[model samples]
Target: MVKPVIAERGGAAAGDDARNGERAASVRWALAGLSLCVLLPSLGISVANVALPTLADAFGAPFQDVQWIVLSYLLAITSLIVGAGRLGDLAGRRRLLLGGIALFTLASALCGAAPTLWLLVAARAAQGVGAAVMMALAMALVAGTVPASRVGGAMGLLGTMSAVGTALGPSLGGGLIAGFGWRAIFLAGLPLGLLAFALARRHLPADRREDRDGTTGGTADGTARGRAGFDGLGTLLLALTLAAYALAMTMGRGAFGPLTLALLLAAACGAGLFLRVEANAASPLIRPAMLRDPALGRGLAANALVSTVMMATLVVGPFHLSHALGLDTGPAGLALSAGPLAAALAGVPAGRLTDRFGARRMTVAGLAGMAAGTVLLSGLPAALGAALGVAGYLAPLVVVTIGYALFQTANNTAVMTGVRPDQRGLTSGLLNLARNLGLVTGASAMGAVFAAAAGDVATAGAEAVASGTRATFAVAAGLIAAALAVTVAGRRARPGQTADGA
Candidate 1:
């Protein structure tokens, strides 16, 4: 009788362990779906970059107008991301994610079918609003769903997906544009978005808001609490500030006229008003206390700076490849794909390293690598005409991408871990906001430099293109060096602490 009882107990233990394994597998699948959602929008951004020249030709638009194709999307995301995150916290991340996917799908369809350049830009802006919602909630959802011990790994995996998406974009987009047309890039998002929406709805849990009392704001049966009030005034002011600033930057290098002056003034006034409104609002869009946190603020600044360098390189590299090197659309796209491919390969390993070592060390190392890579790229034009020219050009991109992977994985982990559980959504929003803002600012700044150097891309000769490319890289290197300095300073400001200073 004793022997029989012991065998039964062992069988019961085995059964329980099997069930746990099954549950873990389910969670992993859900996380994978979430990563897919992240991947789609990221891919869209890079793919659109490669398609810019094609779009300009198709619509007979100038380079300045063509740029708005990219800028409009980023601008919309920057303006609305914080508000989206706040809504996710008040409503539900799963719900908002589903909504975002739907809207993104609709916008993608519209973008593909747009008959005019302005209409296409409008559609891209709408797409940005949808992308912002997804970006704001993605990290927060991951943090909420996964165990704290595994957060770094999960973040890494998500980052990997993002890198892969970006890596694939240029190559895939080039092939599609070469084979079909530029419209194919926009149309590609439709199926991906729809599938992601369906899978997310089925697999992702319906998370409720966490209350101030450390309990979930839900009924006993698990229904969500009432939604919080919206901050319309705060949202409007923030949007206006960002729009004005981005407009100023976009037009700064052009003419330097009255409109630019007015935009700068509007941006200044709007920024001041935004701060005042946020400070006094009952339910602030961004918490003043959170901004005061040294780690968060510095992390955000570093994120923006890094993004600026990365986007500047991406925007400038394709033109250089096509115009200066006389490469076709396909080859140029393939060349541009190198960096993101390196980033994809490095992302997971970097994440694991961050988990094992610490975010601070990895972040510093990453920034240093970025600075070195940018400096090397600045001389690529001179180097490329040598025996090992291609290698010289490609090697620096690999280093830069690897650094980006390490920095992003470690820094994101730091930012997420530094904030309170309830604040994750807002923090995620801010993170994305910084990134998108960087993209817009970098694109504008670098495009201006290229224009000033090259005279006109459509009409410029090879030598002019080369000159512009070299100059842009030089400026980019300076930006990265400055970022490295900031990172070093931030580290010194908080000794014996990790990237999050936790």
Candidate 2:
């Protein structure tokens, strides 16, 4: 009787295992859906870039000020990622991600309806906040749910989504603006956002790792475990400090007078306050120890410098294509699409290469490719044939994006490997912050150059914008060449020594 009962139990257990296996297979698709939800908002910002000139003409704002429609979103999104990531660790990632989609959708409506530039800017900032929350929390959720072996592939997929979204933005915006106007471009994500929110609520398991057995909300089964609580004060300080610092940089050449000085001081005070709070708190926004690694230091610098070059390209590319070549916004936008297209396609192969070869070789090769591409871009004659110029420009753009993809993927893999798994959220936030800050700095610096040169040119305004665009590219080329040294330093300082081994 006992043997028959035992055999029956074993049979039931096998059936249960088969069912669970089927469920696991389905989970992968659901995970991909959630990742796309996190992706679409940030992607929306870049997609609208092609419509900027139209937005400016419609609103009667200067081109420089109009550009902030994009810059403001990038600044807000990047700056808040750390705080958002910390919040995800404390609260639940799924809850935060769902909330982000809701907020992002609402903000998109506001942006679409904004009657003035000020309103549009405010809406864009709100959109950034939503994007930051989605980004940080989505990654946190992925880390919690996915098995270790597949995380790299999933991360690669996420990178591909990001690249695709960015690459597709201009064409999407161009089509929308040409058909219904720029407002349609802002409003395009409404249906998609709603769909994401619904899918997330239905599919994602709650990220609570708290023990069912009576234990404190601490590490259990070797997983990071924390209660749901937010450091509102720390969040505020960080936001203020970054916002103020960005404002000062964006204003350029003391354009904003005493306000810039006040902002700088406020930013400093905010930084000091954040350090105090973080040092004393039970749970901090970012761990100080994470930033102390020598490897991290080099990685951060290289990441920032590379991003700066990217932002410079974004700022200058359209003007060169439109004003210099006398192309319409559609053709110009298409020309600018090559880099991100190459980047998206390169991610999977880059990951495999990193695994096989290690980050050091890949980093050096990437930087060398970028430098070569930049040099090629800088040498084109002012009156070069349109076909030659377009081809030449795309060559560097593709090389640089591929190089960037390789470096970025390898660097992130290295950072994640070097840090404790419990602290991955913080590590990601810090890396993102460094890169975003670089973007802001690059945009502001290049914008200043463009503005100054525009005023100096005795030719037509279009010609002036063109000149500024080419000059900015030259400057970016020089900056990228300088960053190669930082890459070398990173190679030397890395630990554990896998592509995934930082």
Candidate 3:
């Protein structure tokens, strides 16, 4: 009888081990799906840039008017991301995420079939909404999907996917446009969206049903969280504020006109009002305390500044490559690709390093590297372009992006680690919001700097473009320097707090 019992116990233990292994595998698969979901939106952001010229010719619209195709998408995402996150927190992340994927897929179809440029822009805006939902919830879900010890690695993986998608955009988009036309660019998202949907449906855990009181119960305490009612007022104010700011930055074609000033003022006032409203609200969309947190606040600010510096590469690189180096479009695009490729390659290892070493240390190191690279990029390309040409530019840019990958991974890991479970979605949305805002701002501000430096760029010679590149990157270095100062100040401000200081 004893012998029989021992054998049965061993069999039971083996069965448990097998089930554990299966669970781990399932989690890994789910993470892949989540990474792709992140990738889709990132790809959307870049792929459209390459399509702008093709789109203008196809739609018979001025390039200025066609800018709406990209601007509308960006505006929609920036305006609605926070609300989407809050909605997901209220409804169910898994359910909302699936719906988002479906909506994105549908919007892509609409974009492909739209007969008018305005219609295509509208479809792109709708696609942006879906993207907001996906991006907001994807990061939120990471906490639950992986072991706490591996969160940095997970965050790094998502960053890698995002970088890969952004890098792949121009290359893939150019190919599709060359072979099939502009519509194919949008249509191509269909298969990717479908694959993501299927994987998420199969692997993501279902959200627990809310209690009758409309509160989702937290595991730590039976206390109610994710307030029952939505903060409509807060959401509206934030949307309007972001819209005004985005329009202010993007609409003037690099000119800071009266309209831009008015919009900026409006955004500032709206922001002030938003703060007051959130503070007084029963259930705020974004808790005031969260932003006041030293680590989280500084992290968001750093993300924005770093993103602006990074965008400088994109804004200034093309001009340098084409005009300064006298490269053709194909070569310019290839050279422009070096940054994203470096980012993609560095992302996973950066995350692993963050996990092994620490997010705070990695964050500082990454920023320092970025600051140094931007300083080099300011004059290195122009100084060496006579002989080294593309190498001079790409060398510093690759360094900047690798540092970016590291900073992105470390900063995101640090911020997300300390967030309340219930607020993860909102926090994630804010993180993305900061980054997007930076991108929009950088496009306008950096472009202006370059143009001003190049003076009469329409007829500027190669040397003029090189001068612009130098000046633009000089400004970029300042931005990164500011970002670094913010990070260090935050750390000093909260000496007693952990790296994930929230």
Give the top-scoring candidate (lDDT). Answer: 3
lDDT (10s digit) by residue, model 1, range 1-502: 9999999999999999999897688678778778887898788787898898999999998998998898898778777888888777766778888999889889999999999999999999999989888888888788777776677777788889888887888778888899989888999898888888877887787766461213435633475644345678998898889888877776675446799889989989998999999887756677677787878888899999899888877777877777776789867767887888888889889888877777777888788888888887777654354445456667887898899888888788878876766678788888888877787678777888878988889999877877887788788888778777777777743444544434
On residues 279-373, what C-alpha lDDT tens digit does candidate 2 reach at each position?
Answer: 76655565565566777777778878888888877877876767666779778867887878888998767766755666567667777878877
Q: Ranking by lDDT, best first?
A: 3, 1, 2
- Model 2: which ten-residue window has the lowest total lDDT? 211-220
Candidate 2 vs. true structure, TM-score: 0.79
In what order do the candidates fall by TM-score, top score first? Answer: 3, 1, 2
Q: Which model scores highest in TM-score?
A: 3
Show model 2 residue runs off by greater than 4 Å: 1-24, 48-72, 110-123, 181-183, 202-205, 208-229, 253-262, 322-330, 355-361, 379-387, 448-478, 481-483, 492-502
* Residue 468 C-alpha lDDT in model 3: 89
lDDT scores in order:
0.80, 0.72, 0.87
Instruction: Show where candidate 1 strays beyond 4 Å.
Output: 49-71, 112-122, 177-184, 211-228, 251-255, 319-330, 379-387, 449-474, 492-502
Error of 3 at 206 (Å): 2.3
Worst 10 residues of 1 by lDDT: 211-220
Evaluation by TM-score, superior candidate among 2 and 3? 3
Candidate 3 lDDT over residue span 362-471, tens digit each: 89889999988888878674556668878877888888999999999889888887776767778889899999999988988899999999988779998888888889
